[model samples]
Target: MTRVPAYFDAFLTAVAGGAEIDHVHLGHWDAPGAIGPARARAGFAQAQDRLSAALIAWLDLARGHLVLDVGCGFGGSLRTIRTCHPGVEVIGLNLDPRQLAVGFRRDRRRRNATWIAADACRLPFAGGMFDRLLCVEAAFHFASRRDFFAEAHRVLARDGVLVLSDIVLTRPPLPEEEVALLADGLEAAFGPWPDKWASLDAIGRDAEAAGFTLLVTDATANTEPSFHTIAPGRSDRPTSGDVLRELHRLGCLHYLYLRLDKR
Candidate 1:
């Protein structure tokens, strides 16, 4: 048997280890009562709500169009988009069969949505086939950010739009210790963080290189505190509980939302 790619292996491990992938793709882990302890459940729920809202706001999806959701985890974003844009056709692509299975089961009643197991670097669709492309929280996992952008450009119509929300390192951590701390926090939460997360400047550069015009970019740090506070209320435990406190202390979370138009 062939060995699995290291990044994929790490992704599976992180998901299995109770690191919720909700930020990247939406789907609740199906556990007996809940996936994580009560405290963790609260934090996870809060993050999910905020991330989901940001994705919808950024995409501003329209009806009667073809949309492709790359690295769609558990299909949460796809479902949300479809519900919001009733006449739209949504295709969710993911590499993990298990994740796709959960998404399929959850959204079985929605006929306008479809799911496929495929690589992000090489989507199995014709050029200019889609009107909109949305990727939430999963761009860092692509082996080549450049290739990912190129594929997005190729698959999108000339006037199409691409919305992406992902975790990005704001500035290079100065001290070596700070760098290590940041890296550790990310790895603990995300399995393995990407070597170079696209900064604001980098995002603009890449979009231009990929034949897209940058439209909007927003940092979500200020809003994060409010959402984190709200998340615990959805859980069975108190908001100040252990797991919530831990996730907060590590500064293990941050997000950026961007909108681009294909040229």
Candidate 2:
């Protein structure tokens, strides 16, 4: 069994209390309200799946290549990888077994698809276990981004690539007071925060320290559509969404994409 830390295991067990998670929107929704709720949800998921596919295309994969997707919530990207790259064996890893349990259809499990419930910072597999590592909008949740980067470096094959999307602070550094407001915005927009802003240079430094060389870096502010989504029951204070939008308008936040190769 994977030895989850005592406190974190307790926390995750309590959170799992026989339940599921997340409905707020966060992506480039070209058509926000053009359809019904069910259709819209399906479209958003498909878009995210396509985004995953786009990221994986950079790998130039070959037959029988092994891939690991960290924090593979609901296995959306897993489905895309299996369909898009035939003969590529892939693992969908998430910390919560409940997520892995419900991520697939009754007949969806395949010979090449393996799902593991384990922490990102402590991969349970052997060294040089994966050819490509994909993490989409999930790295920020790790207890330490630097720790996860080091873990990623350790598990990836010598020539392997790590492609991930994350939220980071905008350069030209905003006022120190803006940090709290941005945190509130993130809470309003995504309901998750690492309790501190991660700047672009900070991420690069962490990855460099992990024995990896940065290959590609890009930032996108294409989250305006997500801000328009309705997440209710916060009438008491300014919605975190509002704060997020204003800060975004001020160029204080960005959606970052990074591709790093193991040194």
Candidate 3:
């Protein structure tokens, strides 16, 4: 198995508990609605399923359409497609063999689901083959978002849609300040972030340059309060989830969803 990247490993543990979650949204900015721990867990679980369903709905998938989930984690969303959109073929692509190995077990007895070890920006598929390409809170890690956008445009069939959720700075950065709310987060966490955060405007420009027309864009302001409720924490130091929640609270980043159609 390929070695997992440190930041991704940190993300898996702190954000998704290394489980079969659909997506590890960086921040849960919503207020915990006066609920108990057990109820909170249930609520967050439901919210995850809802988000997955919403993305699928945005895909507007039809039977026999080919779907590619770039950066698929444990194949959760691919399995969701297999269950909900029968006859649609779904492929889960990830660079990490460790992830692909675990994800392989998730697609048992399912002819519609397949997993591949590959790079997101350098997709191995033929041009104009896929009806949909999905990225669930996973694009930031790509080496070059522009390259990925170009590749996405090349691989999608005519009028195919690209639906993705991502974290972005509200706008272009001005003079910046850095502050730490906690000493440490998770078992291990990403070191001081390198200047990789991109604004929504930047991503939109990249998509447009790649011949995509924007169909929908919205911030996930109603993100569930999963940090305090679903994931464990400590007072001495923050979990990786805490670091992200703090960043979101500080307005450094926001979760957003976008749908762009191949033009």
Candidate 4:
């Protein structure tokens, strides 16, 4: 069976059960340079909040906007968005049912939030159904990000917006050995890697092919501090974070912020 998603879900479940797994995404630190995780728990939460705020800011949510969080993980962002825009309708779509279960078990007060088990590449929604789509640090596993882009294009309104933060190739092809190692690590942690990571330019082309116009792209260094992990697993153990840290250090991987408009 796939142990990767389970491992992550377990960590998040623990986070929901008062355990600290730091931040899931690379945080968007507002301060100057990277700060060590001296106060890891608080730092991680703060970083997560900052990144969520950054993503939410891009949505420009209104009272009636319908927003969907693809790969919604354990519903942290959903909770934050609901608080920020109480009048908006928020639904979360995830491939892992266990994650959704854990999310519901942890937070039972979401009167207006809905969670569904679904795949990102093949969204179970009608055309032009949502005004905004937000995906945070979870699209890398899609069998094909391009396909997800097309699906996002299909499900989003004509003037809809897509905001995504993900691990991407900042440079060309990973070394053969590194690719193998990284793939193995990711597969062990999440599931089989789809091997669909694309460069910034390639992603832009994919969006264009899917009938989207790029609105903004941010690759600031502020996200580096987010690498300071605090998951339930042993901090010293090599996990997906190790792979991300290595790829990022090698300048081959980046945490990218992209905002696209359906046209």
| CA lDDT, candidate 1, residue 235 | 53
Question: Please, what are the lDDT tens digits per residue for candidate 3 over residues 1-263?
Answer: 22344766654565345454545543332444554456656677666666666777899999989999988877767888888888899899988876776677655765877789898878999999999998887776677778889999999999899998876644323434333223233123543222245667777898999999976545545563555553345668645566555555666656677798999
TM-score preference between candidates 1 and 3, better one: 3
Task: State the lDDT of candidate 2 residue by residue for 182-211, as single tens digits.
Answer: 665555455444534677778889999998
- Per-residue lDDT of candidate 1, residues 99-188 (tens digit): 777677678576988899888888899999999898877877677667888999999987898888765554443577875765565555
What's the residue-level lDDT of 81 in candidate 3? 87
User: What is the lDDT for 213 in model 1?
Assistant: 86
Best by TM-score: 4
| Model 1 poorest 10 in a row by lDDT | 24-33
* lDDT of model 2, residue 206: 94
Candidate 1: C-alpha lDDT: 0.66
Candidate 4's C-alpha lDDT?
0.76
lDDT scores in order: 0.66, 0.68, 0.70, 0.76
lDDT of 4 by residue, 48-146 (tens): 888888998988898988999998877888888888898898898888777777677756676778889888888999999999999998877777879
TM-score of 2: 0.75
By TM-score, the candidates rank as 4, 3, 2, 1
Q: How do all models score by TM-score?
A: 0.71, 0.75, 0.81, 0.86
TM-score of 1: 0.71
Better of 2 and 4 by TM-score: 4
Off by over 4 Å in 3: 1-4, 7-39, 170-195, 229-233
- RMSD score of candidate 4 (Å): 3.2
Root-mean-square deviation of each candidate, in angstroms?
Answer: 7.5, 5.6, 4.3, 3.2
